[model samples]
Every structure is written in C-alpha cells, then in structure tokens.
Target: MSLDPDFAILLRASADRLFFLLEKFASARVLVIGDLTLDEFLTGQVERISREAPVLILRHETTKQVPGGGANAIYNFAQLGAKVLAVGLLGKDEQGKALRSLLEAAGINTDGVFVDSSRPTVTKTRISGHSRQSVTQQIVRLDRKSDDLPDLDLQVQISQYIKEQINSVDAVVCSDYGDGTLTQPVISAALSASRTIVDAQKHLERYRRGTLFTPNLPEAEFAVGYAITDEPTLTQAGQDLLALTQAQHILITRGEQGMSMFNREGSAFHIPAFNRTKVFDVTGAGDTVVAALTLGLTVGASAWEAAVLGNLAASIVVRRFGTTTTTPEEMRVALQRLLEEG
Candidate 1:
C-alpha cells in the first residue's frame, strides 16, 4: 500500500511532542489488572521427516519462558519506563511462580497478583522446529488453563486489590483475556477509577463509562456483530462501540491499515500504519498499543496523540519475533526516522 502523504506529515509534526511524552513515562504509574500468563517456547532442530507419519522429527534444544496476556502489557509499560503495578490471578503451580519471578525481575510490583490453588496457570507453550540454515518458527501451541470459574473468594480478593491501587496510579489498564479476574465487580471498580483504558476479549459491553477502548479490527467486529470491510463500515463500528460501551473514546486497531479513533462527542480520525516494511511477527502488538496509549494518557496526551504513540509502539513490536516489548528510546528513534524520511 502507498503511504498516506498527509499522515506522514502529521507524524513528523508530532515528533517533538511524542519525545516529551516518552520522557514522562518514567514518572507515570500504571496499574494493570486482568489475567496473567506465562508464554513458553521450546526450540529444536528439524532432524528428518518421520518414516511412518508426515510429522518432522526434531532434536531437542532449549526452552524459554516470558510473560504474556496482562503480564505482557505490564512488561510493555515497564520497558517504556513506566512504574507498573500488576493485579491478576495466578495458579499455585510452577508456571505461576515463573510468571511472578519474571514480573519481579522487571521491577514491577506484584502485590496485586493473587494465587489460587484450584486453577491451573494460564500457560501457552509453543514448539518451534528449524533446520541449520533457517530461523525457527512456531509449529504448534499447547495451552493450559482452568475451565471452571475461579472461586468467589478469589474474585473478591482481586476486586479489593484493584480498589486499593486504583487511586494511587495515574491510570488503570483492564487487560482481560476472558480470564476469571475480570468479573463484574472488578470491572465496576476499574470504571470508577480515573483514566481507565480497556483491552478486553470478552464482556466488552459490560465495561461502561471509561476513558478509552482499544480493540483490534476483529474484536471490534465481534462486539458490533458485523464485518468492517471499508472506511464507512469501519466508522460505523467505532460509533457503535462508543454508544454500546459509553467509553469516552474508541480506537479500532486495523493491522497494516493502521487505526481509527472516535470520541463520544462524534470526533473521529484515522492513523496510517507506520514502519510497514519489516513486520516479522504481530504477537503482543496489541499489548504494545495498550501500554503506549495508557502511558500517553497518564502523561497528559490527547487521545489522538495517544493513539499515535500506540501506532509507533505497535510498529516497533511487529518488526520483532515472538512476544516482546519496545522501549522509549526505540520509540524516539522511530519517530525521528519518520521525521527524517519526510
């Protein structure tokens, strides 16, 4: 797709302001409340094709683990220089322990992370096989989670934790992956707090009267119950979300097409995708957007500017493989490069 000429200029003009906001990230405190997860990757060499089956035999290699879901959003905020507090549910298993360790290692406060013995940790393990001459790619993924609702006592504990920290942070992020932590009580407490940004997979409408809603194209379509194929349809989807959820603003993320933002008062605009040349993997790109947008609001950015920062952050993460994060320095460099391009 060809670059939008006016969009490039707008980004160039925002460079100075974006830099200032990034510098303010260090002083911003954000509380992320939702489902926590551990993402595991197992790497091996593709030795040969199986004689009896179509599967390829592999040589065992290494296993790596990182934070995912709400944990990943916290990672993104921390890497961008924000002081982060995370609240979520963790199982009393090894995966939960590893996830807590990863969060603590990043200097994030996990006081709000609760442990429940009845459920298994939400863990996604991906196995990658490769030959000597090429980089490994994920062949398959295995997920471990609890199908049952968490104990009522556990949900109450999570709700109380959010109420305690919501007042202390500059902003709150509800990163729901349809896990049990984001129940009605928790969502109510979150919306009561100031400057709440939500990125939820389920119960999108249940969250009402919030600062912003960041949903990817498909997520928005699901909430609105229709296909958003073009500009007019996309605009209607955004408006419908705003009316349904009553959020102050709605930002629909459209992968390579970039994003569109609509406020409750009928103001709307679109941002073209940035750094489109080298998108290797889109894993956790939405997390990057949520992190950047939340931090932008925390630092007093307008919704439009926050969405722009989100676009830059998403652009950076998509160029990387696997689940990862982007730093403030990286964002500055990206903005500067775009400015130079013009």
Candidate 2:
C-alpha cells in the first residue's frame, strides 16, 4: 500500500526543508543519559546435526560488538554529526571497556560514564548460524543485564553530572531500558534541561514535562492498560498520555503502521512509515529516530518536520542488517527515492 495522497503531497512539498534540517545537525550538542549496553553478534557456519541431541553443530565464523540500547542513541547522534556527551553506568569489566572504546572511537564524549564494580556491563549477545554460501540466521540470544540500582552515592554523582552538563548541551536525551540508570533522582536532574527527549521502555509518565518522548504502540498499550483498536481509542490514549506525562509532545511509533504524533494543544499528525521495500532488521531503528528527531528539534525544526526526518532515518536503517545509522546524504537519497516510488 502507498501513503495517503495528502501526506505524499505534504512530504513532497517539504522535502527541501527536511534537507536543510539535516545539514544543520552538525551544530547541535546533545546529552544522552540512560543504560548503556554492548550488542554482540556471534556468527558461525552450520555444520551438521548433533548426534546426542536435536541440535545443529556449527563452526565459528566471526563475532561483532556494536553500541546498543542508549549507547546506540549516542552513536546515532555522533554519526549524524552532532557533538554528543554520554552519561551512564558501566561495569568494571572487559565489556565495559570495549563499549567505551567503541563510543570514543565514534567520537562520543564518555566522561560521564562511571564504573560500578558490583555489576557486569549490560550485553545482548545474538548467536547466528549460517551455511558457507548464505546469509547468517540468528538462532538465539543471551542477555546480561541488571535491574539493581547503582549505589546511591553513584547515582548522586551521575545526577550532579547531569545538572552540570545539561545546560551546556542543546538537548538532553534519556534512553531508559529500565536498567536502573535512570532512577528518580537522575530523571529529575535530566528534567531540569529545557529540551529533554526520552526513549523509555516503561513508566512513560515519569518523563513528565519533557519536550518529547517516543514510545512504540505496545509500550503505549502497556502503559495505559488498554488496547488502541481504533481511531477513537487511539485519540483517547494520546490525550491520556499527554496528561499523564505533561509533555509538550508525544510520538507513538506504530512500527509498520507508521507513527502518530500528539501535542498538548490537541492537534495530531500521522506520518506513514516509508517502508516501501524489504526490511532486513529493525535493530536500533528507534535510536535512529529519536536521534534524528532530537537533533531536528534542536536545530529549530517543527515537530512534524523533525518527525519526518526521524521517519526517513528509520526507513534507511531498517533496510540493512545489524545496528547502524544513516547519514544526511542517505536521508536525502531516501526522500527522493520515496517520492519516485510513491
């Protein structure tokens, strides 16, 4: 299916404006605070079925570690040309060191990332099995994360960092995977920033008074404890969330259904997902969206315009495998391609 004719026309008309916003990303300074994680991919060649069990034996191929969770958001910001500062917790382990090295290699400032020896660095490992001549297929995943909070004193240090640095950046982005890095004190500290954008896993209400927060449809349903089965229900959920969060804007990301935005002023806009082609993987797509959206807002784009950039950015990342980011050049080409195909 194609987009509504009206939307296609609006997007076509504003294509140039969107390009201008992308060019301005270099000047924005962003602060990201949340749970940092390392996403590991282990790929091996599928050999034969195991004699002792109904399992396939595999020959090891290669391993990869990429920024994930909030770290991905930081990577997106840095990739998109913004000067980025990251604040979070990491374990005093090799994963933590590797994750920090990756962040620094991408040019993200990690001075605010503190070490907590009590817990291990958060990691998500995806194991894949593949034939010698075929694409790798993910077989299973292993997760190492903690729900326990950092020491109260450590939280205080993080809060103090947020307070001191929040004003220096153009915006503060809180990426919460509910890993306890964003405790109440930390959230309060981040809220002090005038422009705060959040990508939270749950408890959406805690980001009250934020400039914007992006939650997918399932998260919305879970937070409200109701299904958004129709337009009326969706509208009510939007209003309910706006009131509950006291945010200036709420963007509900509806996967393939597209994304809808609601503001405190009672106006809403729906942007169709530009998934005009195959989607290989959706890993880190939300991070790309929030990164582009926050940078757009920082550079003075209207909410709708920023959402359009975010949407286009996601369209680019989902076409590839693994966690990745898109550049301004890629976004421009995507817009033109969408127009040609639509």
Best by lDDT: 2
Candidate 2 — which residues are off by over 4 angstroms? 49-55, 133-135
lDDT of each: 0.89, 0.91
Query: Cα miss at 288, model 2 (Å)?
Result: 0.9
| Candidate 2, residue 271: how far the Cα is off, in Å | 0.6
Identify the runs in model 1 with alpha carbons over 4 angstroms from their true place. 1-3, 48-56, 133-135
Output the worst ten-in-a-row residue range by lDDT, candidate 1. Answer: 1-10
Per-residue lDDT of model 1, residues 64-122, tens digit only: 99999889998999999999999988999999999999999999999999999999889
Candidate 2 lDDT, 133-227, residue by residue in tens:
98878999999987788999999999999999987999999999988899999999999998999899899888888889898888888888899
